[model samples]
Target chain A: MREFFERLGLMAEKAVVTTGQIIIMLFQAVYYLFLPPFKFRNMFKQMEFVGVRSLFVVVLTGSFTGMVLAMQGYNALKRFGAESLVGPTVALSMARELGPVLTGLMVTGRAGSAMATELGTMRVTEQIDALYTMAINPVKYLVTPRIVAGVLMLPVLAIITDFVGVLGGYFVGVKLLGINPGVYIGRTIDFVSVNDIFYGLTKSAVFGLIITLISSFQGYHASGGAEGVGRAATSAVVLSCVLILVSDYFLTSIMF
Target chain B: MVKLSAEAKVGIFVLIGIILLAYMSLRVGGMRFGKEEGYTLTVKLDNAAGLDRDASVKVAGVEVGRIKDIKLQDHKAVVVLRIKPGVRIGRDFTAALKTSGLLGEKYLELIPGSPNAPYLEEGEEITRVRAYADVDKLIADLSEVAVDIKKVTGSMAKVLGGEAGAASLSNIVSNLEEITYNINAVVEQNDERLSTVLANLEVFSDSIKEVAAGLNVLIKENRDDFTAGVTNLKAAMETLNSMAPEIKHTVSSIQRIARRIDEGQGTIGKLINDDTTHEKLNRTLTGINSFIDKTQRFRLYVGYRGEYLFDADDTKSYLSLRIQPKADKYYLIDIVDDPRGNRRTTKTEVTEGGSTRTVETTKTSDEIKFSAQIAKRFGDLALRGGIIESTGGLGADYYMFKDRLKLTLEAFDFHKDRNPRLKAGAFMYLNKYFFITAGYDDFISDVGLESAYVGVGLEFEDDDLKYLFSSVPPISF
Candidate 1:
């Protein structure tokens, strides 16, 4: 029991230290955003790759998720003669929670893991060392653009997801179920509010920051050759997903 | 020159991604940098489901503004909406968040108040807002109501068929069957009558059209005459108004007479109100029937002897009577006797026999035999029983009276039958009982026909009995 208590104390200490480090990192990011010698071109290029290129996959996943949600909600509500409420059910779920979280997870798997692997490979090949020797700041040159892109791209992806998900719900709810389109849309609007969308975008933005930081941190600390780089890529994805879920709850509690 | 390496490619990709995000943010996120040409308004809501900066704002379903900012102040959400110039709201405008489509992004919607009201100023806070009515809770409540309704209906079905119910179902079913048969018969009998009525209606419609045309012609030809008639009516009304007090006095006298009759104070009132009059009438009718019976018997007895004398000639000496009477006219009666020198003649007569006779002679004529008879007749009359009662109260009482009084009218047994019946009458007091009391009493019995009675009553009051008369106006006339 003493050992267990000691372990708990150590774990608590580690948690505090990690929380402090994250806070410092957040402050650094905000500070860097407004600093001189800003890399606008790099930021723009990263945004295109992350935001524009990932649009189709995000929309596809979002629409299917919405259709599946409607089907499930309809089945449950129909038992109680409340199938008409499916519209608001789908709308509120997507706008408040699923739209942001799902888009973050998808982009993290698609782009976050890829970013870590590319950077890890560069580190193993001594490209990062070469940049250091040339007196260029590696954080600014290698990390800033990707960080900016991830942070900015996520909200756009979330918006697209929200739009496509609604359309998917409409297809299933109206076309398939023969519900009046006007009533479905009216109920959706009536049930959903402005705060739900705002909360989702805010969550997406935070998730973007976490993904970029995890991928870059894992890549920067990579040591072993090919095997080590592969491990970093995998670990980056897992950590990013965990952080996203944990942060989502906290953000929701605070916003709501 | 160094060829672009994998690191550079990745770097460039990241840069591209950043630029694309910025562009999307500006385009799709509805981000605006410069001041827009609009008036800004703020609203505080307890909850904001999915609103954000740059969200579109609509008025009357038209895009009139966009959300500028959303922030929490004092634990409440403050939303700043930038409305377009020339789009006006009122003090009573309601702000609500609406989704564009199912699961779509939410936008701020402003419901404009009355147009005639003063417009809201720039930067004014809109206080009225409608929060989302929780769809899940509403659905739950509706389902609960439906369950309650089902339960009530089920209970009602059980009560209607229980042992102690108002009617035996079997009796009701038989009555229903009889009613169905009667309805079918009536429908069959009225088929030709209905066709005649339809024909008459068509003719009436044509006549109405003709009348309308004739009226139009008359109006065109006698416009002056019509105006003169109207003028004359107006003058007559004026003259009546000038003599109103005298007319009112005359009307009051007539009303007093009516009130006396209605209160059972005079002969007509007693005839209407007293049950003894009905009993006396019934006894009188019975006595009349008995008297008619005695008179008919006297006539029959007087006519009977004439037939005996007519057939006397055919008999032998010693006054033997032979009578052959019509069967339908009289009851059967017979007599036989014999009288002769040494051979006796015997005769037999029947009151109901046909006109045929035979005579025979006997050697021993010393013994004499005689026969006499009498008959009685009866008539058909049906008896019926019923009870009637009336009660009288303005305003809601009038409406109640109209409904209840009509029920009484459906109770009277004009054609009596062998059935027990009940009848009730209701009268409404209108204008403090100075108004008329109308009542109807209908006999409730299974007599295959409905009988109804209607009567009007008036009430009176003196200083000593004013309160009693006012409260309990007698409802019979």
Candidate 2:
């Protein structure tokens, strides 16, 4: 029983420290964001890496997700004789929930894992310590740009994803299933408002901050050589994905 | 070996992202840029349920603006709206707070007013507003009504389910069945009487058929007479119709005359109104009254006759006068316009071809003439000898029933015709001045114009008739 209590205590302590570090790191990132010995170059480099490179996978995931939504929505709504609602259904889902959440997960798997691994490997090899000896703050040099890039790039990626998803929904709804084109488009415009898209974008931006923070924190503290980097990368992906999904429900309730 | 600049690649990537951001913000967030991009409006509401900044403002379900900011003011919520360019919101537009769906999103719905009105200017407040409906209150009211209905129906069902009510219902149904049965029985009992009625109806139909057949024969036999009667009716109707416009004109003229007389306007008006002319009329009327009272002194009779000849298809008219010299003696004079007076004909036919021959002949002569005669009455009979149509003739008259009926005989035109043309007729008095005369005209030897004729004439005192004639407008022709 003592061991179980100790284990619970250890878990609670770890959670608190992690949350505290994330908040501190967010503040430092924001501070650095303005005080830019502005690595506009580094920010752009990271943006290319985060947003441009992820476009194909994001688009593919988004369109397929939307097509499946239309198919399922048609069947469900057909029971109620409201088959024309498929467009609004697919568009709303992509804009309000799926676009941000799915983009967060996919980018976590692609860029978040890489960020953790790269930073972790540098730490284990004493590169960060070397930077400190040169009187350079490693966080400023490395983590800030990635954080900024993630925050900036994620919303853009989600917007692209939403566009593709609506296209896919249109192809499936109107061409494959013979839903009225006017009703499909008109209902989407009618129900899926600007607020819903803004909600999605805000969620994506927060997801970006969470993803970079978790990955960078894990990497910056990483100690063990190769195993620690690998561990850090896996945990980064898993934590960010979970955080994305968990935060989504709260954001929807509060924002809507 | 690497020549590419990382900055350029990153710049392009960032540029694309910025472009996408612009597209996304404008398309999805409905955001715009620039200082004077869109117009701003203010609206105040009593209650703005579930509304916030950036809530859409729609016209006819199409979004044209959005809430820029919402603030609390003097016990009310005031909203500032930013409308897109070219979206006309009339001054009288109504702003209704509406929901996208039940328990879904809420928006400001602006229903436009008439199109011709001036637009609501920037910064102007929209006066017409509707608050969002409280669905919970509505549902509560509906439930209350439903509860009342349920109570009423429950009592009704209880009343209908009672033992006595059921017995009454069953009895009523049985009574209805008995009534229908009695009706059927009565109908069966009257079957023979219904048949007898039907047989009498058949005999009545036969009698109607016989009457229709007799009418058909009568119509066939008198078809010519009916045609003549219809022709006469048509001529009379034509005359009356032709006189209608003239009569209307005359009526208007008479109205003018009456008005003129009232206004004392022209000679007739002067005659009626002037004392001298009035005195003259009064004296004439008095003299006529005195003469009528002294009818035994000069008992003269005057008559006018109009006759229609079927053979000649013409009319003959006459004026007759009878002067009483004593209580039993009288003189008669007549003026006649005869359609058939005399006839002459000459015929010549060429015996050889191409030989010229001509003949002139007179078939008939029409003229006006006067005839006079003297008669002495002995009780109800009179003997007379005089000229008839300017030739010698004699007549005897038998009067009956105070001269209401008279039979007369005349022989005239002896030198002109093959045999003396004789006329025999009886006069039947119909009224004070009218009589009907039917005569066998020129039937003595049938060589002259012979006809069985019928005519009507008027007989009255000569002085009375002469006075009436003088009062009328003179016939010019």
Candidate 3:
């Protein structure tokens, strides 16, 4: 029992230290945000990397997500003779919750894992150390642009996701299931509001910030060999996903 | 599989991204582009259920605008509506929150008021607003009415069913029985009066029986006188019976005489049966029938006319016939028995012997005279001008009630030295085929023919006139 308690204590200590390190790293990244060249070249590169490149996967996920939502909403609302509500149901889910959440996850898998792996490889090869010796602020040079790009592009990606998701729902509801087009679009406009989309974009921005901070933090702290880099990349993706889901709940409650 | 960099095509990809974001912001996020800014109006609503930003604003049940924003101010919802240009909203317009479809999503409903009201300017708040009714209150009121109906139905059931209904029905039956029993008691109380009436009736019947017995005894005593009278009647009948043969002979002779009459053998028989007499009678009948036929075409008015001569101081009477063919045309003929006749009279006084002697002279002799007129009717008035009593005259008639009543005026006996005699009379039917007439004749002429007279006359329809008018047989082709 004493050994078990000791091991638990060690685990708790590690959790606290990890949390503090994450907070301090986030502050440092924010602090470096204003101190240097704005890094538009790097920021645009990351934006293309995060937002443009991830579009295919995000769209695929969004379409399937919306079709499933339509099918499920049709089945449920039809019980109350409200099958016409399927469009608004799909729209509200995508604009307010699913669009941001799914885009964040897909992009995290595509860009965030790539960010961790690449940075981890650079760390293992002593490139980041060499940057530090050459009087370069690595966080500003590497992390700020990535964080800015994530924040900038997640909303763009979410907007695309919302559009494709609603299209997919329309396909399933109106074409496949014979719902009236007027009822589908009318109910969507009647139920969905701008605030829903705005708050969803807000959640995507937060998710982007989170995915960047955690992925870059894991990459910055890499110590082991090539195997350790893989672990860091995996942990970054897992942590980013977990944080996204957790923050989505709190954001949804606040916005609602 | 391959690497694409932002150094090439990044601008285009980013541009596309921005464009898509703007599309989503304007289309999916329900925002508007800056180039198409429209007019805006605000509304303060009491209760705005299911209202959200970017909801549609409708006018006359069609979408004309969108909700720009919604906020709570002082516990009331303040909504800004962005309306497209060229769509006018009156100041007295009203806004309400209504479901788009039954039990579906809700939207803001705007009522464009009459054009006479002021136009709604941009950013102006509307005053007329209707909030969603509280469904719970409506249901509560409905339930109250239902409870009242239930109470009424329950009372009806109580009256129609169960022990209370039975008790009331029995009570009504008992009251009826009691009323019948009271009537029986009242009949019993009048027993004495009823018996007295019965006894008086019995005594009167006994007196009548006594009178009938006395009459029977008187009849027995008069039996002998009745038999003697019957015997006398029998003797007279015997005398008649004995003369039957002579009477039979006389009847045979009369039969011969009747046969002779039928054969045109005697003067009286010839008078009845001769073809010459028959021909004469037929000619007379045809002439009379033709006159009757002419009369049948007319509605006849018979009037008694009297005239008083001022100089002669004598009254004359005449019977006049007015024949009306249609309501509008008539002919008048009068037979006058003039006492002073058509004469003009004069009296002169001469003082030859110191005593004045009056000498009367007549300018014309008394004569039987007549008047004739032809009238043409125009609505209620008719114009008549013709010879009247051997002189030219003019007259008028006013008809009433389909000519059942009339007032007539005849100006006749016109003279240069004297005014024309004007006769006015009112004629009315006392009954069908009978009339009474009253008139003053010569009211205007001072020399003669001025008199008032009233008389009733029979308007006779010749008995043969009916056959003459109706005897046209059915024409054969």
Top of the candidates by TM-score: 3
**How high is each candidate's interface RMSD, in Å?**
7.9, 2.8, 2.7
Evaluate residue A211 in candidate 3 and report its C-alpha lDDT on the 0 to 100 scale.
95
Question: How do these models rank on DockQ, best leading?
Answer: 3, 2, 1
lDDT of 2 by residue, B62-136 (tens): 889888989889989898999998987899999888886554578899988888888888899999987554886
TM-score of 3: 0.50
Sort candidate 3 into its docking category. acceptable
Each candidate's DockQ score against the native complex?
A: 0.03, 0.24, 0.24
Give the distance in Å from residue B93's predicted Cα in candidate 3 to where it truly belongs. 7.9
Which has the better lDDT: candidate 2, or candidate 3? 2
A-chain TM-score of every model: 0.90, 0.97, 0.96
State the lDDT of candidate 1 residue by residue for B374-397, as single tens digits. 222121111111221111100011
Q: Where in model 1 is the C-alpha error above 4 Å?
A: A1-16, A124-126, B1-477
As a whole number from 0 to 100, the lDDT of residue B226 in candidate 2 is 100
Clashing pairs in 3: none
Lowest lDDT sum, 10 consecutive residues, model 1 chain B, at B388-397
Better of 1 and 3 by TM-score: 3
Per-prediction CA RMSD (Å): 38.7, 22.1, 31.5
Candidate with more favorable, higher DockQ: 2 or 3: 3
